[model samples]
Target: MEIIHHHNLAMKTEEEKLPPLIQAIAAREIAGFDNANNLHLHDLKISILDANEEQKQVSISMPSSPIEVHVGSSTLYPMSDSAAKFHSQPIPNNNKLKYQRFDSFKTWSGKLERQISNLRGKPCEIHENDDIENLPLDRFFDALEGPELDTLRASEEIILPENEKWPFLLRFPISTFGICLGVSSQAIMWKALATSDSTKFLHVTPEINLALWLVAAALVAAVSAVYSLKVIFYFEAVRREYFHPVRVNFFFAPLVAVVFLAIGAPPPVAGKLHSAAWYALMAPILCLEVKIYGQWMSGGQRRLSKVANPSNHLAVVGNFAGAVLGAAMGLKEGPVFFFAVGLAHYVVLFVTLYQRLPTNETLPKELHPVFFLFVAAPSTAAVAWTEIRDSFDHGSRIAYFIALFLYFSLAVRVNFFRGFRFSLAWWAYTFPMTGAAVATMKYADAVPGAGTRLLAVTLCGVATVAVAALLVATVVHACVLKDLFPNDMAIAISGKRPKMTRKWRHRYRRRSSSSSSTTDSDYCQGN
Candidate 1:
């Protein structure tokens, strides 16, 4: 035992004699090493890298000293729920301390590795998200307009039908009313022809006057035929207007009655038949007056501002025309009633229209029914008054004077008249002008004055010139212009196209093809 103890002391003395640096190097070479192939980290209950990768609380025994954890060369602080992993080889329990420096070149790489689990538990915070739900909806709505505010308003457009649009001869059936002028002028000429004393002033014989009556009668027939075509083709338009709750359309009724009265004066079977028709028509005309007048009063004129044109007095003119016809037929009661109604209603209409109607410049010249206000109503009244009283009485004189003054007012604006477009409304000028001429002749005969005779002669000359011009224009428009039919009714009963329509259609086809080609090329370029 003494020898064994002496040998152990000798070996310890030799190892203690070795260099200190060699001994430290030998210690480091034998120390435990952690590497990627064998090292792992897990929780007490589960591995963070498990298939489910669910997070759970882990109980770990913390060391008093700090730990140096390495993951892919990244140095990390101690994890809150970490468990140290070791290789299959057991590490020596030594108290030796060691330090190692990391090189910049190999900074992001290491022999050891680590895996992160439970990605949902360590989600990165987002700075901003522009979801629509996060917008200030209440603030936006508060800035909007209120419910009472009107975002849109209305405007008016004159949408003329293709038929009534410009470049048509029979654009409107209202032109048929021009028949009244021919009939009235003929009646006056016939009266003058029958008077032996009239030859000196008129410078025409009874035979010439008879020929004029025949011509006037022919004109009446032509107009009636044209109007019949209008009724057949445009029944709905005529019916709607005829029964409208307004008095202007009522004028056309009396115009028909005037034709009957004119024909009745000649003492023939045709005259008797026309007179009978006139008598039959009187009842319906009276009914129409009552309906229109009653509605005008009751409705308080809902559209008065828009419709208060001088045409409103046309109703009054109709009554007077009826009175003249009734007197010619020797109907005492009818003439008196019609005359009174016409006079009273016309006064009211005149006052209202004068005050309320738009200015001349504001009104379109094509729609100048206002000219009739000064001419037709007063002249018709004068004629009716002369028939009732059998002379130029106070009422007849007053009516004549008013008619003359109104005529002058229109005459002074001759340039305006010339500026007017060719429309059915031009027919308005014919009736009033003829009526004035008739009134002048009646006044001259009743007064028996030189000045009156000269005035009568001048007016008749003017009426003749006007009628002749209108006739030429009508024939030219119908034959040459070929615009006599309204739109779709352009084809005649014989199924022949109008000359103008054939030309227009050819032009339309050429333009349409050119426009279509241009549009197609434009579309291709755009695409």
Candidate 2:
């Protein structure tokens, strides 16, 4: 029996080159044969085709005899030119490979195209040389252009997802309650100026005080309604803010604003409403005081030294403010109780801040406005003591002097107050300034003199002007600029990535990359 075997292998490249394709075919054929096999060939022929479609052939005729053939096998597996090129290249690490898979899938499914289209008119360029698989995470961000780049450049700002119905509202921060606190405190200061006998010369009328209180009430109602919506819609954000070291202090501001409204209630509305409001809010304030004061004294993550900053004075100021409202409502024991707790904590906080303990976290320069809080606590305490005793005696005067000294000290460092762009934090200046002014009015009433009267008038004027300026600036920022609710600190602390940016598109890339061990927790904690 005679058997003949004819094997044909065809290979082609984009260029349709003859030499490389023939070499690949030969390699594949030789690799298939075992070294131990013996074969006899009568005729051997090789054929090649070039890009032009022209064929060249070679033929060899062997002698009419059976020829033994033994071919050695190759250790390396044979591959086509393209496969060889891919295999020869260096393999990326697991992280890069994972990102490559994700990018490939995103591109295949057209999700990437949909995202780019959602950017509207923003221009993005992908160069021909750019390998999406091998692109560095940072370089990918750098390649982004137009308004998309601007959105990333604004480090404090973030774009909300398209699915969100009210993106602007979601960005609102808990610190915005400081606005209510400042405005209501201003109403109180104006009422003090209008009602007090010593300052009757300033011509502050009942109508002016009434208007301020009305405006403050309107602001408080508006802010409360908006924040209630935020709490319902974004409870996780609210929960994170509640646990924040600095921001948790501002939770006291909303309650304090209500208390101020009750204390400074216009003559037309002061009778039963003031007492009812005070009684309703008293329990929550004391409960918060116990939880916060306990945390401070217990020595843990929320300990005083770890979290102490000028903002902690907000929690201190609330107690004194509540004490003043209690005294006004004819509650004797409750007023003294609140006053005692406030005084005890204020001393420890004051000394902690004054000594600048190494363990204490420091505030960013943009938040330096809260330093005025040093003035707020003592001044509120002085007023609280005066209300509790029904007279501005030695104890009230001592606290008032400390506040006055700190106010002047902070006032001289003009550079500290200036240079920062307007923010919700600027409201920190208003309530504290108003508190100091209220204390000064008490001082002027206690000791009538030219110097004391002038100082009283000056502080009241400054507080009024500061509150007015901040109010106007906040309006313009919200209406014209439309950037009043970026929630910088909240976003930073909560570890939520900004939406609609390329940075978040490859979040998995960042996670998988061994070179980038940074996590959301690390980023949030570091900030």
lDDT of each residue in 315-355, candidate 2, tens digit only: 88888998998898788988898889889899999898898
Q: Count the backbone clashes (under 3 Å) in each candidate.
A: 0, 0
Q: Which stretches of model 2 miss by more than 4 angstroms?
A: 1-166, 274-276, 357-362, 487-527
Report the number of the highest-lDDT candidate.
Answer: 2
The C-alpha local distance difference test score for the whole of candidate 1 amounts to 0.52
**Clashing residue pairs in candidate 1 (N, C-alpha, C atoms within 3 angstroms):** none
Q: Write the per-residue lDDT of candidate 1 for residues 1-527, one digit (tens) a residue.
A: 99998987766556334243211121122234322234343324433432235553433322233234332332222323343332122356553311111110121212111112224355333212111122232222121111111011111111122223332223444435554554555555445535525336555645655566666666666666665665564443344334332324534544543543463344443336545655666666677668656655665432333344565656666677777777776668887898898788777667666674532123444555446555888988998888888777889989989999989887876545554456444556666776787788788777777887878778777777776777777677668886543432211111112244566667656754664575455434423
Q: List runs of model 1 lying over 4 Å from the truth.
A: 1-172, 179-184, 193-203, 229-234, 243-264, 267-278, 300-306, 358-361, 483-527
Worst 10 residues of 2 by lDDT: 143-152
